[model samples]
Target: MATRPASDTQVLAGRPFPLGAHPEAGGVRFAVTSAVADAVEVCLIADDGSERRIELTERTFGVWHGLVPGVTPGQRYGYRVHGPYDPSRGLRCNPAKLLVDPYAYRVTGRLTNLHAAQGFVGDPARGPASTVDSLGSVPLSVVMSPGGPDTGAKPEVPFEESVIYEVHVKGFTEQHPFIPEALRGTYLGLAHPVSIEHLARLGVTTVELMPVHAFADEPSLIRAGRHNYWGYSPLGYFAPHPRYASEPGREVEEFRTMVAALHAANIEVIVDVVFNHTCEGGPDGPTLSLRGLDAPAYYLHTKRGHMADITGCGNTLDAGSPTVVRLVTDSLRYWTQELGVDGFRFDLASTLGRPRGGMFDRDSTMLTAITTDPVLSGCKLIAEPWDATGEGYRVGDFGAQWAEWNGRYRDTVRDFWRGVTGVRDLAFRLSGSSDLYDHNLRRPWQSVNFVTAHDGFTLRDLVSYNDKHNEDNGEDNRDGTNDNRSWNHGVEGETEDAAVLALRTRQARNLLATLLLSTGTPMLTAGDEMWRTQGGNNNAYCLDDETSWLDWTPSAASEPMLAFTRRLVRIRAESPALRQPEFFEGRTTVTGKPDLVWFRPDGEEFDEADWFDEDRRSLCLWIDGSNSQARNREGALVTDHSWLLVLHAGDEPLDVVLPSREYGETYKPTLDTSTADGTPAHPGVLEPKGRITVEARSLLLLRAPRDIVEGPQTP
Candidate 1:
């Protein structure tokens, strides 16, 4: 039980419509949702560390409200919910724990003492409520002025044409040479000219920032002297993380500036959001905001009153409830409308779809709200498409208006480049994955394709390492996934062998080219284009030091790869054949050829029986864009150049015969992965039936000419 404050502060009954602490003309109206609290007090903390408590006298529909006079902007405050301490019933509320407002737009501090915030005295699940005052140790919510960002014109790039680049805010800017020393590793640093210039040059239309929502490091990590550098354990969804802001007390403004800079560069901003779970862990975890307010209503509980740990993060929010739906949608609208973010990439999104009984539903309340919200009408929504539980992998299961991270696309492409498969599934992956995403009228762009992401071996590492080396993470080399479909070309880790090094570069190019040229929207991991590696550490979630920070220095491997990547992006942008919104129809075109055809190296088209040839390692994807069945926004047919992409993953070089004149009269070399910098190995044009040798473990991209052509291109 909490004693009332000593000082006399006038408190009036405030209306409870919009939740959270909002400052108006008279004062700040504080409203908190606690379905099971006996009484609630808005504890105002002074700058000098003293606290004044004002009890909210009005209770309407499980919400407690009060208008505390004289409370202005920058006033730090918390909540003390007085209620039952019955863990068996999932109502573990204790006034001793200072609770943050679930709708707080800005929080000012970190939880220094973890144990002091726990509600129980002995065993956390069965013991009595502790009386330790968590006033000075816990984080406090600050009242903010209702001022939105001065965002200029929004780029609003169409979904099908988007090329996403997933980046970490700190790692991307921490070592940037041109960023100021003071601003490095901050949001303003990312907004700087050099950062924007790099992104613009890379041709990425969207930057999916990893978790900008305020998060807390795990207590286990704190005890081990490590940090959760990924920012997945969210503490406040509405706030821009203060750790990334250069100017203290101005995180919202700094984040807005970063968004504005990206918009100015014709890029969209998409934040990775974790709304499934929070920093408040399980039944034994600390008494954070949601747990202290009403654990049963805020968290999913088992029949035995234990918190459902489906997220593998302890507590899973009961998204089926109307309260949780309102919470998530409100947070999304705030980020979209106030701070000026263009999109969101939902982390562990499968849990949100599973609103009840641990069963996933496509039409859950939370999903429906986001899909229907007018505020989020045209915003891009990308889901990670899985959760911690084994049953949460719902790829291609998302309904209308939502895109999913295509895991199958990544696996198939990696396996194909590593010579681990025939071109059966590889063909499916390369041509929009129609089998997976063509249901319910989902287009090819609905499958966000990638060969590598934030939590796996990088593109360079995928070709250079066969096993994970996570010993630096202090997990005794027992962290990260083991099923890496990667081939190290008979050499593991770094080596001095010239042949092996050349092979690794080519393999990397093969993977990157496949990702960029695929028919779905590609999402490239940051720094992968410049030969970035984590020393084979697939999981760098806890390592915040230089091991995780992106090295911005140019080197022998970095410069060539960057140039190659830039050229590839340009090729993809210029070539409409690669950006097909519709899957191949196999229909005859105006040129008396099929819209899509798979040809063998012998200049013969692949028959139906050729798909089951398990030993075959080469295939050609021919796209006839001139008679393409795809349409623009106006539903008019688009016509572009026809293309032929050749992949030969065999150990020996093989001579490839160009297709006959039905597709095109001659072939113009566009890019060859065998070259060190994606240069054309064949500098001159080759006529029909001509033979060109594709070296071991490489790919070649060629375009058909309307007439005579000028040889291959140089980046």
Candidate 2:
């Protein structure tokens, strides 16, 4: 191969200690890792679109290094690694293809699905090296100045008190009327005063933004004129997605500004990171950054050189490799330390804990490394805890330090509120799913419980659609999950019948109540509190338009629902017994009462037969806050007034007899989900063993005074 002269710009052998292009005092040093490549050329693209090829003269421990004297920050560059182009051996190195830097701080342009971008010269069907230069086809990695130190402090809310709100940065503010048109759907919009005030009023402790890493639209989606709206298909892990920024080259700063703003509002920021796979699909996919550099080292491959697709995204990252582990850990540290992010929620997290050709391991190298690392261990680390590979549904199998998205909690809560499952499963879920997470010395907060997320139906759709409406995804309605435990409440989709609409509203309240009142770290999807809908689209991952954006316009149910949600959050915050950190021991404590007691509608403790009774849907839970095992910050035992929570999932209102005088002498109603403002018209006191009416598909909380008093039962 012929090389261009280095006469125009002086090049020197640079140090290979730090990867990617780093701008120093006089020039920029470029370093990239390509273990199997025989030659590597760093192409510097000038403002006029002219290219200067500088071959890296020094190779240190598989890293090619070169320094360009005149090149500085904002210089657009890419790599062309030369080696054998043999895909069967998992080595597809094509010098003609302009490759992205794995550690690119910012990517300048978008990638088009053109034939020239392919590694092969001719049709990819024949599998031959591409002699055509791909300099103009692929995006260039821009050399960026290192970000300054984060002087802002992170809002490290304790897990027991945290209420997470998962939102897509773009979708959350895309249609907000209060935000300026130029700033809408950008990081600045998310950090706007209106956004922060709404979140502060709603009482969420953390805002878990879905994947913001620099990502690419899949070639197939582009071919079909669709887009990957979720931003899960990552291209560079270190860079923030440029599309979400207000201006060019300001993504990192804008992301930091958003984090600072949220922190100022006492809300933590948890970014949803997708390190399990890349936009570069299967073995026949495009030759992007990692694939062109060293596919075998970065991705898991079968014996025949095929990609091991555990993430269902074509290729699963081989976290077992030290190189990949270093890359992931470094990326996380950068986000937490430099960008001021408080935590991370790993997407497809099971893939990170699974070994090659093995099941998901609780003690995987990646899991141990993350939990033991000093910086990451101090920060919150949450896992989705499941993938699409073999036995990947390890919900509670993650390390003790890590919290998991409790899938069992989600399913059981949905089933119970849908009025299909029995009270037994509901009881288990309400108590933070001890059956799934209790064995590993995990606390209740370790289970991040939620009814819906970005991947599934929104809370409104959960009560409006019985089936997923994903035809707009351009996949012929074949995409998205089928096991949506949803009920349409008398009619499918929107309804005009007053009774039907009322029932839907009631059911939505019931679901939200269960999620908040349950003993776990509850996660609320962004617009669930205001009854946002996706028009029955359960999987809006591909719908970037109105179907996915949160409509700020108030609907008929918006005010009441928002008020109810705010009240629920306030109640959860005020009541320590509802959000206990420890598991219920089911035994008497120092206060001479069990921390938790279950009662049937007849005011009797649940028997074994009652647990197995499928028809039993309403039950009463007496939580003895005075007997709580949780301790306060000063190491003293915390104490609060006892409380009673009545849950009724049946179709008709039921009269529930309060537990006998032994539990408490007097009870006062605190919250009722059936009421528009979550407060009853007439405040009343009830004697022990008194009967209180609970509406259909509603939840009620009663405060039981610690001091015993003989009081008359008020109807």
Candidate 3:
């Protein structure tokens, strides 16, 4: 692939359909969408450090395109769109500042010099466009081939059976001792043998990796000497973040390799994506990719020309626009079809479903496009179903095809364990949040239930800290969430008292047990199984160092919690009743027993009176496996022993009376969260209607004998 002569570059009018730089046998054809630009030029940087500027003479519709007969794949380039710089009219284009392709597959370098990256070259305070050229300072897009060899088959785990482990790519392996020093904190590091072994041992079917898309640190964070460790601020939608790649120019391949490795281990890879906003902040922000190309069309703006801050981020992408929708859909297809991702978890997903300046609608253009798109509909889709704007807390409103992060489950469970709420809300969470998700013919698994996530406290810190400890995040500790429903067991922070440590450990187990055994798709934070803590920092989004990394060196408390979590997962896997595919309707089965039964501590059926009992800290749930509608590998109806799970969140142990023999004759204890091996103090079968002791702030699971025949009872 030789460089084309200036004459050929000047004369060739390229095809404009593909919308990015496409490498062909003769040369590369460049195309970009800039509806408002008067002129667009493709600035190609050669291997010899020389630059060639080719004005895209062809315009089909709103796209500017041209071809250079010799430019090949590996050539670096950027776009220079000539347009007005009027802010009030929402046009912020400046040809002086080099712009990245909105569909760039790979980008090199960072936006270190903000002033040079901004469209306004002079004093930003004066709000005027800069006349100086930014070709020397801004990062350039590297043209690359679009397709690759198939990296094996995806695991394609079903949502009902999937257990998601949300993890940060770099932070997950940053302190991993088993990973090689050079590979640690990179894409390759996540696919390391040790990382795979940990996930496999923990029994998670999917690894929901935090954002790996190319992102930039906020200028405010840069000035404060802090970085966005979570990678929520996206820079390039098509490219993997280069900082997470072990080697230069191999970010895409490295990401594909990671996905392949996880697939080989039968674990799916789901990435958390931020399409709600870009790193380009408010009106005073820099002009990088879409903002510079056409801010008015790319972002949702108020009538006064200010950005609609629906994401709490300074700017929100106009997902309703046809151009932005195409960009998003194309990017999703690239990741799933080309990069081999199993799924995606959209952050602030409600923002994507909002029509310009309107409320969030389930039938909004972007949401409907995604769920109906042939390429994307086949892949798993998860939504963080809310934004920071009006009516954004839509936990169960994202239709049946999409699963949601149940924020209500998190808050209710935390409140229950903290003794701030009664058994009513706790029962709802434990039963897969049926009240929230059951309206639209949704199954139990539509609720992705969890008590902790990346944006909140770790399971360990949740028990050790009463309030968020984020002073180190700067901004005088005002950045993170303050309403962290956490409870410190006697002490506020780290304590040396054995009694306090014991209570904290038990509370941690209680939370983990509830999360794994609950009737929904449970998601565990990466380090929660190993008792990882952020030093009480509920939000460590800014701390890229030790504060956010998982400490591989386990503590005394971590070992037991890890063992307990593994045992809980195993029990859940063995018991089909625990992970029911459908919502429990309380209908009487052929066995003369309800498919699901709820009881008070005294062995009586729970009535309306028991729900509002403020002092009630315990409840008993019986799940009938015989009522399951799932089929096994042999195409036979799946059935297992019925299970009775007793959960007590009180401060003292209590005697729980078992249900009558009408349900089953005898029960065998399977798991007790208070014990290291999930063993009960008195192991063995207990007669039906017998009393068993449940420990304080812990959960117990018992399996009913399969041989016991159902007795005659009234339906």
Candidate 1 regions with alpha-carbon error over 4 angstroms: 1-7, 629-636, 707-715
lDDT, candidate 2, equals 0.85
- Let me know the TM-score candidate 1 reaches against the reference structure: 0.97
Better of 1 and 2 by TM-score: 1
Put down candidate 2 lDDT per residue, 1-715, tens digits, no spaces.
2345666776788899678889875999999988899999898887777777888879999999988887878888889898877766777888888889988889877877556666765544356787777776677798999975352787778899899999999999999999999889999899999999999999999999999999988878878888899998999988889999999889888998998889999999999999899988876677768888888889998886777898888888997987788789988988898889999999989888886747778798888888888999999899998898558888888878989999988898888888887888788788878887897778889999999999888888998899988899988888899999999987889889888788788888888888998998999999999899998888778788999999999877898999999999998887777888888987574356687889887888899999998888887888887666555555455666688888888989888888777677788898887887688533699998898888888888888877322222111
Q: Alpha carbon lDDT of residue 242, candidate 3? A: 91
Give all TM-scores, in the order shown: 0.97, 0.96, 0.96
Clashes (N, CA, C under 3 Å) per candidate? 0, 1, 1
Superposed by TM-score, candidate 3 places the C-alpha of residue 405 at a distance from the truth, in angstroms, of 0.2
For model 2, the run of ten residues with the poorest summed lDDT: 706-715
Lowest lDDT block of 10, candidate 1: 706-715
lDDT of 2 at 315: 85
Best by lDDT: 1
